[model samples]
Target: MRVTIDEDKCCGYAACLSVAEKVFDLAADNIAAVLVEHPQGELADQAREAAAACPTSAIILLDDTE
Candidate 1:
């Protein structure tokens, strides 16, 4: 999966960080950022949850596991 975050849509809710700190983090601008381009195993699961937890829907998951 390809995790992408739209900083503009981020509200600094830190939901992503709470769920997937290893995959997502706050940038210098205080917006959500994808730390890992693609996560696997449990990290992947958390990433998806993080994306869903985003109030602004800043997180976008692009599945490339075909």
Candidate 2:
């Protein structure tokens, strides 16, 4: 899967980091960033959870099939 974050919509909540540290992290600007654009297996599941945990819905997840 492909993971991305809408920087404009991120509020620096760090929720994504909490859910998927390997896939997401806070940038110097405190916005959520995709550390691993493409994740697999457990990481992919974590990415999905991170997207759901995002209060602002800033995380965007695109399946490879798409």
Candidate 3:
């Protein structure tokens, strides 16, 4: 699965980090960033949870093609 983050929508709440720090990082501006473009195995599930946990809905998950 591929993950993308909307920097403008991220509030730096660190929800994503809580779910998967390996796949997401909280920048100095507090916005969540994609540490890995494509996550697999357990990391994929964590990434999904992180996206769902985002209050701002900044994290977006796309299929392999996307």
Candidate 4:
């Protein structure tokens, strides 16, 4: 799965980063920055958790599997 953040929608809650530190980071503006485009192994589930944890619905998860 691929994970991304909509900077405009981000409220800087840092929930995503908290859930998946290896997959996301907070920038200077407190917006979520994607550290990994496609999460593999256990990181994939972490990525999904991060997406679900976002209060502002800023995290976008794109499932590559069909």
Q: What TM-score should be assigned to candidate 1?
A: 0.90
Predicted model with the maximum lDDT: 2
Q: Which stretches of candidate 1 lie over 4 Å from their true place?
A: none
Instruction: For candidate 3, give the lDDT of residue 13.
Output: 87
User: Per-model C-alpha lDDT, please?
Assistant: 0.88, 0.90, 0.89, 0.87
TM-score of each: 0.90, 0.93, 0.92, 0.89
Q: Distance from true position, residue 57, model 4, in Å?
A: 0.7
Candidate 4: worst 10 consecutive residues by lDDT? 57-66
TM-score of 2: 0.93
lDDT of 2 by residue, 38-62 (tens): 9999999999999999999999998
Query: Model 4: clashing residue pairs?
Result: none
- Tell me how many residue pairs clash in candidate 1: 0
Candidate 2: stretches off by over 4 Å:
none
Among all windows of 10 consecutive residues in model 2, the one with the lowest summed lDDT is 57-66
